[model samples]
Target chain A: MAPTEASERPSLERLLATREIMVACGPGGVGKTTTAAAAGVMAAVKHGGKVLVLTVDPARRLATALGLTGIGNKEHRVPDEAFAEAGLKSRGELWVAMLDTKQSWDDLIARHAPDEATRDEILANPLYQNISGRFIQSHDYIAMERLYEIHSEGRYDLIVVDTPPTRNALDFLDAPERMADFFSSRLLRWLIMPYRSRLVNVATKPFYQIADRILGTEFLGDISEFFILFQTMYDGFVERSRAVGRLLADRRTTFLVVSTLESVPLREAEFFAQELTSRHLHLGAMVMNKVLPEYLRGSEAADAAHTMAEQAGELGGLLSERMGPAHEPLRDSAQVTRVLKEISASFLNFQTVALREAEERDELSVAPEVMVSVPFFDTEIHDLGGLYRLGEQIWE
Target chain B: MNDLLDKKLLFVTGKGGVGKTSVATSLAFLAASRGQRVLLCEVDGKGDVAGLLESPPTAFKEREVSPGLFAMTMDTEEAMKEYLRLNLRVPFAGRIGPVAKAFDFLASAAPGVREILVVGKLCYEVREAHYDLVVVDATASGHIVGLLAAPQAVNSLVKVGLIRNQTDWMLEMLTDPAQTGLVAVCTPEEMPVTETIELAGRVRNETTVNLASVVVNRVLPELFGTQEEEVFETLTRPDVAAELELLVGSDTAPVLEAARLAVTLRRTRSVHLDRLREAIDPSVPLLYLPYLFTRSHGLRTTRQTATSLGEELGY
Candidate 1:
């Protein structure tokens, strides 16, 4: 849910000191990767412990923001040069990597399988192949294993992860419980049993016999083989998804949800935050990033220019009431500045309404801190230097 | 005079989080100042075009941002939804919620080229010469080729009215160099520039549109003033020390230690810009937008930014 009052909320700082797994999640282009890394870098530099920043999608922006060439599964030390030019002295530093989902799955199987034979058996299966090897975007639970791996590595003080932007942003957050629920469901259990029983007894398997007769094909053989292979991995995947649900719910694990001060995205943010609560994940903060602060118009010189700006815009009267106090109109430029204040106010009001709706979510929420990251400079956080600048704003 | 300008449309695309918006805005500013009636269009669903415009974001049916400058942020879902409702004349818009959701889901989630229809529609807008100049912010790199290749991707998928006609016309427009120019945006960093150049190659192979230009946004101009040692020495001096108190922000450092930061900040940012220049094409003109003291660039600042472009490009 959206945060109702900052007074009532605890905040990210309070949660960060306590929580282990702090997820900075939202939809694409909302600065998820950079925020996670900046916070990771900032937390490390501030608290004197290494912080890991893991990105999912392979975009250059992530690499440049960390001031690195290319990032992969291996956690590389963020070179001193990366933030050196930003002119800040750092204490501890960020350890960065990108999620190699397919490789991660292979590694998980290699580590967890009962034996190499069972591992081989599972990997050979097509269903396993589909989910593990070819799942276009890996499931949340699958990604969680990667998160858990980084968390357990203990090299970093905290693991700041940028989760893959799921087509449905909330789907990644909600999928684990749903996947586990599907696995634990009785109907699925029944469907799998018959499929498993067929693998052991070909003669008595009615569905197999019926399938071969109707299709004149060996589809059931392939299907049974697929299930048999998946049967070994199914319990583990379900168990892992369940543990993720538990880990995400831990009081110390904070979810700092980020969004713009816009209605639709904030609405999505509120819905996603509520989904976390419904699923029992700990809420840390609802951070409204890129907020537009009020611009008040006052000076006599500015007043005359403001009046002129109002004359030009359709919403000038509203500007006169609210956001104004614009730049001193340069000599001979009074006419051009006309109604500019009103246009600025209209945009500011849109932001105000968006932030207010976000504040309303605090009434039903659990996050201790309801913070907003106000809009400021920089078109894109292109490099680590940009992130270094972005990090300063977190404190200021 | 506006009608006399070259009408070549520029389409900018890069991987997500690349400086696509800035580059597209700069290119539009570049064209507009050149006296083209530039209409910068964003179909990325971000309303980024409006964000770049001096005007506030609204319904986005082409509002004027400046003289000879108009901009619009296309809501793909809204545009496509309206298109479907009006053109296809779906019996009931509400009843087709499931179908609409399914179409969007399948379009986004279905593995291949479900994007052609929407892209085909966008292509139609550009093809129609609705504006003398059209600059599109295409989807991120991963889905863009398949998105651009939607027409060929849909030859067998279906045979329909506007979808078919739009797709065919879009293919023609995109393939015509004189009519279209595709520019990939990148930063000076290795990955953005590398992927940008790589994508340029891909564009040439996949389509015949002119690879107009690649604009690298936010490159630092290396300053050539004080040496590192003198900067360090200047930090230690007493009078200069007290003077630094008001600005050098930190918990650990006192006023005296603040000078230590200036050298690093000044030296490093310049090196980055030099690296960016080395990585990008030397011939492609570089437009430097000075780091603004404020973050959310106001209308005034955006105009300043555009004016800086005008001066640099001599538009």
Candidate 2:
């Protein structure tokens, strides 16, 4: 189970071995977070290095399994004892950090602010408070900023980061560039200009009048004051964001697009993969999770199901008579027939879905370096053992 | 509480990939088929509503995709333009280009401005009585709270002006239980259920809108009852399965295994369903929609879902 061993098939293990950052991103509700954690766990156990998983949100039990409970904005090492508890031994350290968006934003402001007074004032600003707390795109921007900050520290050999669920998967990829542009835009200058100079030119007068009438003078003043306070940190913020953007485009950084075989999410993931290629970022792997079992697609099984459905009465009578002595429940021919019909119908129903999934797989337009399919587990993956089992399927 | 469709405005939201758009489209379809004039607006502008309806793509201008059913995709910039044209009466159409560009920048920087535009447009439809009902395919659970609370957020920030004045009526419409309601859709799974519960709490505490109902989508069918399940177990035993294979002239193991998988999946999901039932307020109706075992998703699937929804609503 050595992740470092070379195999004929390209595996996530081999991909993680070469990359410094592996970003797990896709449409939401596709087990992106769990896949990211499993990759981090496997890399630590098999590749023998300090592996860190920076995740936004994980299921309660999975978080507990990784010992990430109630800890935010701080990285915690997954103690060796937990691996022992899960009946495993890790060859290297594994760390986990949950992204705290508000805290991350405050930290970014603290880092970029020109002075302590400016930092305090910005932090206390109601507008700043609202943006840090409820701004949707702020989540996208801060996740990348935190990853950049963590990677620059050189603390781990590998960082597997799970992206926040975005309206569009491409949002985070463009967040840093957007942030940089926002700081240096001419409109931003115009926004804060009138307040600083107390003079409105003819060209800007209409803009001012409309803004004043629409948003009110008081609200406009609050916005002006917030931006003016933000102006002092503009250069630092712009430089930091650009560096974050560059880090994403670095050779060692790669993206893993996780998705299910469902049509809507598959379409979104395909668009994401294409976008990554278009942006010149490395698309390392595409892990399709919760795939229906291959056995469900076998012609032999389908034939059996069809036969059972067609001759349930005769089959039930025959089998019940043969097994009536050992199983009393089989003696009831009508009930046994019902059971046979139900199971067969259920099987045929699932076969249709499995076939649909196969068609969706075939229609996937983009191919990454590696494509992996993980079968749907009957039970939820809520523990370290479950994660390990899931990881092994994609490990090759 | 059962008057879900009777409300003038209904915002359907859920975690992504949980069939939120499908549920919203189905609700609109269901309403329209019941002889109600319905306007369906997609707030995210993903054009999923159009795909679900098998109609041409929707845009800022609402189009009649079906008889008595109109669909549109929300564009905050277009909404702002419409607002300027209608409310401000400022005939600056030639000059709106720069103003819109500037406003787009402001919408990005200012927290609730864009959200307010979307909510304001929907509320305006309700106010003008443009349709018997308006169904909005709103943002996912993660952002819906912010979107629903935008008017209040704007009110707290803006002390005076036209935008401030506009918030009063929108808030009035949104806060009224009879006029507005929110439907939270989710599947009986771990993440979607967890998020639905969390969203329920946030919507109750933070927003003025009413939680009209919770739609549990993709619910698996129970394959067997107690006695039948016992018989199924006995049939799955190795000796019985081997005999059955001989009789059927094919390997029955995979067929049986698929059934077992289905049963386990249903059992696991039922636990989460129970948790969701316990977590949500008892007064809010829980609507269950079966998992459609169809070959493709299109108008056919939408019709099936709408039929199921119609039955759930006691039609």
What lDDT tens digits, residue by residue, belong to model 1 across residues A1-396? 786663344655445545677887765555566677767766766665677777776457667656778887888887878767666556877788887776787788877676899888867755455455434335455677778766666666677776775545676666677666655654334234655565576433443342334223333344445554545666776877777767667775777787764444555577777777787776666666655332211233233333333443432233222222331221212222232333223333333343454354444344435565645342556766667667656633
Most TM-score-accurate candidate: 2
Q: How would you class the docking of model 1? A: incorrect
What value does the lDDT take at residue B39 in candidate 2? 98
- Candidate DockQ values, in order, are 0.04, 0.88
* TM-scores, one per candidate: 0.54, 0.98
Lowest summed lDDT across 10 adjacent residues in model 1 chain B is found at: B247-256
lDDT of 2 by residue, A331-371 (tens): 99889899999999999999999999999998889989999
DockQ for the candidate 2 complex? 0.88
Docking quality of model 2: it rates as high
